[model samples]
Target: MRAEPSLPRHHLPPDRLAELVRGEGGPETLDLLLGGERSRRLLLLRMLDDATDLGPAWDLLSEAQRRAPQVVDDLLMYPQTGMWLTTALRRLRGRTPMDEPPLWVELGHMSALAAAALRAEFDFTIEVPVRHGRVPLPTLGCAVLPETEPWTRATVRAEGGRAVIEAAGAEVALPPTTGSAGPGWHPVRRLTVGARGRRLDIVLDDVDPYRTYPQPTEPRPLSGEAAAQWRRMLEQAWELLLREQPKTAEAMRRGVFSLTPTPAGERFRPRSVSAGDAFGGVEASEPDDAVQLAVTLVHEFQHTKLGGLLHLTPLLTHDSDRGKELWYAPWRNDPRPLEGLLQGIYAFVGITRFWREHRRAAPAQTAMAHFEFALWRAHVATAMEQVHRHPRLTPLGTALLDTLRDHCAQWLAEPVPEEPLALAHLCADDHVARWRAHHRRPAALRPSTGPYGHGWTGRADRPAPWRPNPRSCPTPRHAGWTAWRCSSATASAARTTTGSRSTGPRRPQPGSAER
Candidate 1:
């Protein structure tokens, strides 16, 4: 009998898992999460190959693995590759319909990863597909071939030691080592924020075909002015986290790998999301200022951490999402699954923790900060009550829910200002009434065929008004909307403990808006 190859195994001790349950962990925890992702990618590749004939793409990847292992690891580690690999496998297994990119282009992604690796470390000859005159190299960037027509393949032949993209009769230069690729190559933009001795590196990923998960959009790279603005805002936002919440800031630096910039929606609202499938990625609309930007980073990063944690071990004994309507989450307009409910509670713990510090850390912004803290603290505690003792929860789930509840419990002793507390209460009551109206069936009011109080009032027959679904269009987001919009330049704010500078209440800039 032939011996099968063995795979690597990862084990997390009980204490380390406990730290993550409390919504707190250090480098070791993050490393475990990300390290697990690599193993997942390897398994995905093996399955994908067995399910379909990957052909030369598989051969290219095998060669690259043998000749340039480091480059192979680096390219596979890029987060968007995770999204692509999962979606491609789903397509192969008939879990999802074969859609627009077509199965061929999807398989071509493996070739793209292989090509990028070989380009970085070895001289290799390969042919990569060009869809609508664009060659997308997974991590590097997309090479636009204006000179070539539709549905073609670009040949990458080594000119001496360098790999160049050539299609039709023209050669497309890769993003430069020393200079810009000019207009032909739109490279993925990597931006960084540094404070004290620590730094966070993230890609503003506008070039990948698979970057969009929940809702896909066209690849729209930022204009020169817009890219510059993103750099400025990110630096300012990173500074705020480093100053007020260093530990959370460190957590972000450890995990968050990329942000896919979504177009801005209506004023007073900003949108952001992260998913369990895409562990280290976030999709967000540009916020009004640095503080709002900082909050979005925290909100998305919390989801990222939880997503990674769920991958490590099972929380529920059975599927929690066979029907999501069973669980009610205050932060969402729609009901969540038990797992989804838990995700919301974990994220709000971080958000509430941010505002709890902000109210005292920057006394000038106290009222708004107090409002956020009060609102989220109530909502999280409420959700925790529903899911904390779920019958389906394994002991791991129970531990996580209890640790989070205890953290929220500690915040109960902190007092908010009278005015903000009143406002928070009013908002909470208003949402409860609306949610009941939206979901609960009220008695149907009869026509005036009879006198008042004489008419029969059966259960209300009609459904609630339809709001925009995220699966279709951009709707006004209620979750992070309140935290991001400064709404005006006049709302001046104070500095942090170290006395560095960033935006307070941001005014709309001449050319800036979310999009």
Candidate 2:
């Protein structure tokens, strides 16, 4: 039998939802989201069980739940567990074959979760599959076995408060669950920081296979020095957030669960990603400073909050007329769908708020903070308008946009430094010009569904950022960017209905925008 919706019905008060959409939600909001996510986890487990034999995985989980309910619940909420079950079910249903990991390895994640939970409570033995001779216990670390095959089962037995793992007839005692991995064992490390008498424990999870989103990945376990570096940076970032951005800090404490560090990138501009499938999981390149790391957490947690909201209520659906429509996203080099625009808006709202608060918090950082806040508020404001009148937007989506509209209006009214604001205007104008060359068809031409038809047929005059009187014209001038069709399709106008205005200063860069 399949599991059904467990909560009476998941809901958020409109006022609370508005607060959440505006990126302020306390434990009450997070609790509802966590419960909703729990139901989803149970539903996926039932679906996987119905589709394929979960073997002893289910029984082990039940036993673990009996022994340590909180441990079982915590492991279930691990980002990778959600990722693994979601992919496993997709594969079992014969969908996304190329995108998902192998079914055998995917199913093995169940045993991994169960082992960690059961091993936490009872001195029990179980067998979990190993990949490339390394058995990964999700939320824990990987256990590398001797004489391992490409794929084989490892027996893990925990007794007398100690554990030993064996594969291919050779056994090794597990290393203590702190510091570095032993000669043949690697354990996941934890980072803990506290403020106001409450502790925040975050898993520095570089050893889980499902740590990466959309698919399981080979563990790029951080070396000792690298791991130590991550811990130091995280502690600093946490302290920064706690001291300067308490609301965001409390939110992160309530939501963010794990950090999976990618290879280091540029000193200042590190890359990061968050997936809807993995709530509370953040993957980021190593950062150069606590500020860089703090901002990344602030930005990614926006995606996390919105991702959680989406699981409870869909904000939009495919338009019957346009099917799957794509529109211009100011932040990107290409066109995006309405959903993407919403995600960006929600994230940037949080980002904009972060910089706004940072500017006020640290006097030395005000200049850079002002520019970021200005640039993002403009992008977010325009993006909000781009989807403001979208037909397919649901009521929940509308409310979200409306909340953003109110917030952006307040931001636009606030004064910004002239130098940074001017640069922000320039960047904003450059982006629109690039978008035009890439996607606009001459307005003279009738709307087309032609292959390669995203051009304006006639004279096209677009909006420029209101540099003259920004207070009066807060909505930046954006040209009527046409709907983009990658494979020769219909052209729908997005910002077309808004009247034309003065174009910004033009700098003719060589290359055309991406088609």
Candidate 3:
């Protein structure tokens, strides 16, 4: 296995990392770690070194502090406070350089943060009113770094239609514009969809667009032209949901109550994200058309449902001896863990299903939809193959895999056009080739036995059989299609004829890579 990055200097050392890992690092350590920039920076680097550009990440943090300066003290009071947002930004931008950290890394960090909160024993959440509606608030972290050098300690609460902060023998009301209650609390609009019996309030929050998560994009409310565009998009999305994906539409009706409308930097763009069950809402940007928006809705809601399921049961069993390795996900340029790969399959299953239906209703979009169905179905089937080969799943996890596998099987069995099938196979071949180049060693040179294989060493461009057997690529055997085979001679001839002046494997284009 490859060695990981070293720890940052003048900060948390190996012993300190052990302390944290062992749960021995308590309040004193938290205070010390939070008091300076070094410890916090080190913790973030450890969690995200592979995926993030450290300089750009810090630049984002500087902008975040500028936007919400009040949180600076809070950041210094908790070791992991600044990371949640910045790491989220990194993931949103697909900046992860390698595989994501294991689930425990994040779960442990959040648990530690929760444990250190002054209000944890009370088990409560603060609610602050924002012009149109009240939002749930997180417990204010320790107002003072207790038992440390003398520092200001304050508590914020809503009283008499104003937010008052009481600290160190003084009381002051915070002006609404300067300070916010905290992250995750924001003003939002309620969008009630469907009829009386099935009515659901999808809270439309434009706040994500305003946040610094994407960087360079400052926070701004939806208004004037932006607001008008949002309303139209929502209406169209709602209509498509009711028509195309009734079950997922019902999931939205039952499981989702909040919708955050993030701004699309460009027109005719669709963006949708869900931060798991902990953050109970879907954040989506305006889409080019209702069909795309409908697909985004289905994709995110699947994540919301699975996120909740994850809290109740373990999916992948923990194995201490096994190192975390990145796998090739057809949709992403970087690698993903088994868990992240599983989540991607879950979300895209619904998306593939959406395209399965839309391919018929919208003739103009049929080609694209057919292609999407073919791509996602094949990828999902491939992921199921990986899971089956690996035995690190719990009983419940095995059951969950069965359910998803069954869904993929049915989808894969659906008849697809030959053009779509060819496109999907080509994409699979490209992704596998890239993965082999990045992670695996080349096949050893061997004497050729075939008629045209004379004196040939194994080279990707030569008529060599790829490990994935790309030329004789196998689709699901039960899917009623014979394995698609391209003659090695033909493949080699094409590469030679094209003189491709290879720039290297192509990185995924924007809008082409989905979460």
Candidate 4:
């Protein structure tokens, strides 16, 4: 039996110590520790003396698995170290033998080594306590392990050439096997698992070796049958808009209008998840006039086509802002600012088009009901910065930019309504009041004091960060203005026949604009 080593007096934070024990320490430290021929013996002695509790030791093992699971196999080289771990597991399980092969292999080997070394010093048998519980292990199988104990049991089911395991109130199914078989192992196959819950259903797949979850399906272009219907609807909408609004029609002919499809299985409303690009192929279930859907499609398509010249790039940047790295930038140059602006413009355009097409089918009040104005405003500001950077616009580009700016300005200028809903609500009275209070500042402080910080007059006409006061205004005048503008010249005639004055200010009634 090996003699127990003296404990070190050095102190380390729990997490840091866990990292060191897991071999995540820098190379200098690891190499030094492993340099000598008797390094293994030294390590075993040190670990036995240093590990005060099983928690830290368990953490060390877990971190080793996380950093490099293969390192756990290396522990076998130190017979005493392995025995210590096995003994620890047995103690955790109250001395009950582990029922699962994987668990046994993981714990038994380590404990056996520790027990062998301690046998000379202590004659009593050690019993480990285990707490029974189940957990969902994706792709492999469900396992029932003692939460407090190391002993565990697992029953895996084979269905549809996949392995199914249930644990932690989840059902996990592994992918079908593939590739040539070796003496004891086979090539890894694609693993897929689905967890059904009372309120949610989650599906995960392993397409990459690192076990990235929720793998995306390949982008599917419109099928022949679907393509025909899509084209027909687009053409009909285009023709109708062209005949009704010649300017809008001209914009369409000049390739100012764009179309894109959202990818399959993506949610547009209620919630959104990170998957493919923000916008891609359209979904079949999407409403033809869904403002959000239209905005996403048109915005993304614009990024694909005239993005270079317009400086409206996609939002897929590879910068390490938060958790991302610089390698994710889509273009050589940072195109996020330009893409953001385009996304905002496209969102507005899509919403406008939807309103125009479905005015009769859906009320104008309901338009832009679900849009978030603050987010859109931020996008507009981003685009405006790009435009300011490149102020000189071609005749065609100037016209398009002018139109977009005018639309955005009109929305901004209109009085924000009280308790407005959707992006348009930003133009409503109550919202304008809130915007003003929130944006209030001394007049001496130029527009730079607003959210945009840079003055609007600088370079390009960027959006002012100051939101209109919602309190000063009681109702949105823009919607009324738009309605009045769209009305026929005979509006006065109708007013006269109805014996009602047409000059009174209009107020948005409660719940009149819900989407």
Tell me each candidate's TM-score. 0.84, 0.83, 0.53, 0.27
Top-scoring candidate (TM-score) = 1
Tens digits of per-residue lDDT for model 3, 361-454: 7654454566667767777777666664457677656756676677778878888777656665665655555444444433346432332233
For model 3 the local lDDT of residue 342 reads 72
Q: Per-candidate RMSD vs. true structure?
A: 6.9, 9.7, 16.4, 21.3
Task: Please report how far candidate 3 places residue 398 from its true position, in Å.
Answer: 1.8
Q: Give the per-residue lDDT of model 1 (tens digit) for 216-270.
A: 3435677777877888989998988888998888877878888888777554456
Ranking the candidates on lDDT from highest down gives 2, 1, 3, 4
Once fitted onto the true fold, the runs of candidate 1 whose alpha carbons sit more than 4 angstroms away are 1-8, 147-151, 215-218, 443-515
lDDT of each: 0.69, 0.70, 0.47, 0.31
What's the C-alpha lDDT at position 270 in model 1?
A: 65
| TM-score ranking, best first | 1, 2, 3, 4
Q: In candidate 2, what are the lDDT values of residues 1-515, reduced to their tens digit?
A: 99986758888887768678666777678877888888888898888888888878788888878877888888889887888788787777778675334567678778778888744557777888788778888777887776436677888888878877788777767665544567777788888877655557889888788787655677667788998898888888788788888867876787889998887653333667788878899888787677778877887888888889899888887665441456656666555556766787787787788778876886655555666677778878887876775667788788778878998999999998776666566666656655655554534455442222332232143453222111221233344221122001100111121123212111111011111
For candidate 1, what is the TM-score? 0.84
Model 3 TM-score? 0.53
List clash counts for every candidate, in order. 4, 17, 4, 51
Writing each residue's lDDT as its tens digit, candidate 4 over 96-151 gives: 35344344334432322232222122222221212144322212112233345334
